[model samples]
Target chain A: MIRIGIYGLGKISRRVIQGVLSSNNACLYAVCSSSIEKANIFKKEYQAEKAYDNYERMLEDRNLDLVYICTPNYLHTKHIQIALSYRKHVVCEKPMCVSTKELNDCFDYAKRQNCFLMEAHKTVFTPLNQKLFEMISNEEFGEIKSIDAQYATRLTEQISDWHFSRPGSGCMFDIGVYPICYANRMAKSSIFRVSRFQDEALIEYENGCVAHIATSWDVDMENTAHIYGTKGSVSCKNFWKNTEAAVNGSKITVVQESDFTGEIEHACTCIENGMIESPVMSRKASLEILKVIGV
Target chain B: MIRIGIYGLGKISRRVIQGVLSSNNACLYAVCSSSIEKANIFKKEYQAEKAYDNYERMLEDRNLDLVYICTPNYLHTKHIQIALSYRKHVVCEKPMCVSTKELNDCFDYAKRQNCFLMEAHKTVFTPLNQKLFEMISNEEFGEIKSIDAQYATRLTEQISDWHFSRPGSGCMFDIGVYPICYANRMAKSSIFRVSRFQDEALIEYENGCVAHIATSWDVDMENTAHIYGTKGSVSCKNFWKNTEAAVNGSKITVVQESDFTGEIEHACTCIENGMIESPVMSRKASLEILKVIGV
Candidate 1:
């Protein structure tokens, strides 16, 4: 089995543990929480061999082959770098750092370490989005005319915490990064410049395609991206959900092109088979994502 | 020939004259420019018998059946009211007026005079857009999820020329009105609430549809709008240009759906066929446009 140590026992970290436990080829080796109490709870719940409050002490065990980094926005780069220095393959969560410089440095260190690193970029790994990339890259929609992608989550009194704080979290960097990534992925070339405002970000790529992306923690949550091609347009609602694809002005909707869950499972199996160093979230892609997020 | 009077002999007025003269059903009857010198020159060029420097004197002549108002943003209400008082069919340029109150007054006057009053919204006259609308209204694209519309004409140099001035004109009220209208049309509802910022407009309607419209007189120009439905999405470039509709995940790029010139001709012909008021771009519609623009 491919043993793994998960760092940061937050909500996302819990989700990662669920995903790992559900996978057939992987097993949880250890878990590192900020407190010994939470770590002990996770270890007892998951039947892990050990639990450690200090992540560095856990990394010294050398039995774990991979480390999952699921800390806050500020701690991602540092945790991933520490994991990489231990020569362990790493899967860091989104917004891996707060700036391009830190992401670049982390990438250079990963290259020098000669170990695998991947950002848990689930959007690119989804089935519908993969087909979207293929169709767009093939010029199926012809030349791109424009793009509008946005992710807005409502932060009413019921669910407002740590997201609206200054110096760290907000909608633009936290949720806006997905739509920006979508625009960057479908554009013919890299984004040349970005025009950022309070809750919106307009990015102009070199290939004459422009993307308008906005995010808001102030309103209810919505995840969607739309691409306007010369010949037609394509739209997807809830970019992170397993929703069906709907074609505008045509009879096609909910294209069952590929099984996304199956693909991800297969990738995990490949890693276990030693057929690949890591899974679909390649190190190179993670670095590019970091650059766009400026994190 | 249909006798026509031209009001507000500005640059757009010149374009309308060119279009009208080139048409078979219309001929110039009188000219009214802000200055007597310009009106006299236009009258001599078009071989008109009358040239009035003042609108009150021009309205008293009683020979013209139609009047086209191409004045500044703030002057639309005053000019349209005067034209309606004289029982002349009216076509006023965009923004309609500086505020919703002005639009309501114009609409009320048009109703009282039993005259035709349109805001000269040409985007709705595009053929490709017409096709998309037919498909959507016919439930071809299922229920709409959202509308992402934008129209940005890079004219930072002209920002000081009253078009981008505070209150009366800027990116949101000037070019942004087109996309807002499109969203309002496709959504089939009036906007209930709007959050405005320096660079963005977030509009939500009572009918469960949302529009994120961004425009800038300070940035490079890109004109486009994408309508997203639960079943599919439709898009057009240059909002004024009719273009193809590509369905999501489909490879085919159809062309007939892209041509919108036919629709413009048809809408204009409908006016002479006693279709004095259109469902799209009606007086009520202009009021909604003004509401979003916040005058």
Candidate 2:
């Protein structure tokens, strides 16, 4: 099994620990946080093998085969570089890097180090979406004609300051990436034209498909993703972490222990195969998300 | 009572006949078509008093107080002008005019002739939508913040050549006006910015409301309209003619004779009140729809 070290003990790391614990090909070996107390707390709760306040200290453990970076958006590049420099495979959270340049640099460094790397877009790697993609590839719904996905939430509680003023901030980078990644993955085509207005975008694909992706923090939305095609359509509510979807009105479901497990398992599988990067969430795929963000 | 004459015995005119016949404040007095046989057939079937093959012949009748113009889109300006010339109040079908210039010209002619004129936007005039608009105006769902409306259908059957090659021909002008008018009416604020991509548009309203309206002949969409506010949400399926809506989880419904009756009755009410245009669908309101079309 891949020995996974989590590089952040934020709220998302709790879920990552659950994912690694549930994953067949991975184990939660260690955790690092700015607060050693928090790191030790997570280690005790999730039964991790080690905890460290320093990222370098965690990376120095040669047994750590993979690192999962869940730091804030602006710090992703730095975390990824340190993990990769240790010759460890890495899975970084969404908005992996703010722009394409940062993305290219991280992947290029990973290439030089010969370590597996990928952006963790759990929306596409979820078993439910994986099945839908396979079905769409088989033309079950005919050629995709259009897609509409929206993710909006009211900011009810306090959030980190970086979410507002950092380089990779705002609702688009925070939550918009969910709908953007979902649409781009299902489209199975390259982008043709994109028009961004506020937190919404209309993307026209080279294969004659159009997608409208929207996000906001002002109000709550349906949080639904709809895929339309010539033959029929598919829709799922709360699609970012959904375990089920309606395929032309028929329910297709998957039992998921943790939504993040599939991505962890996939990342571990890629590392085991001696792959330098995930074929599914490759550098090109990571760049496409930023391309829609116009970075 | 308002004695109504319908011009252009096309497919939509049948519904107009049903509306007028069922209306308590209006009578279907005359039917006009280029084909005298078709006009005579419609008049007899709908119990009209007269049938004429020529527009001038129908307008010659002194009792024809109102003319409902259902001509093809590109010809709406001409029909509205001639009807106003006869001192007849007019209600033209959607795509009232292709451009703001034509809309102003026709309304100005109506003003000079002391005749009432309004565009028949059935989506806004539908009884259910009127109630929703009133509820929104009253802030029953708090302040409106976002609206999303879409109408799309596949071209399964051959349509008229005008649908492909006329001035107001594309999907945006054809059925797109439904969602545009719906969003504009619900927003209840002036437009701030608009981004048009293919047949989709994202509009920001002055009061901080955002609307995404879309249409296509390439695919069939959900055909739903969602109005989200600060506190709650409202959604209607097949919203163009829906008689019911879900308000924050509860169903609100209205009984209707024909979907077109509300607009026809509103037009007749405006003429009876000695008003030059409908307060609900004023000259400025009609211009806003065309403005979003970017014509």
Candidate with maximal TM-score: 2
Model 2 ranges off by over 4 Å: none
lDDT score at residue B196, model 1, on the 0-100 scale: 56
lDDT scores of the candidates, listed in order: 0.68, 0.90
Model 2, B1-295: lDDT tens digits are 8999999999899998888887879999999999999999998899899999999999989989999999999999999999988899999998989988999999999999999999998888888999999999999888888899999998898889998899888999999999999999999998888877778888888988888888988777889999988788999999989999999979999988898989888888888888997888999889889878998
DockQ of 2: 0.54
DockQ values for all predictions? 0.06, 0.54
**Candidate 1 backbone overlaps, count:** 19
Over the full model, what C-alpha lDDT does candidate 1 score relative to the true structure?
0.68
- Candidate 2 lDDT, A69-164, residue by residue in tens: 999999999999988888988999999999889999999999999999899999898989999899899999898988999999878999999999
| Candidate 1: tens digits of C-alpha lDDT, residues B109-195 | 877887777777666655556666777889776676567777765453533467655446776767777787777777878887775
Candidate 2 has an lDDT of: 0.90
Recovery fraction of native interface contacts for candidate 1 = 0.00
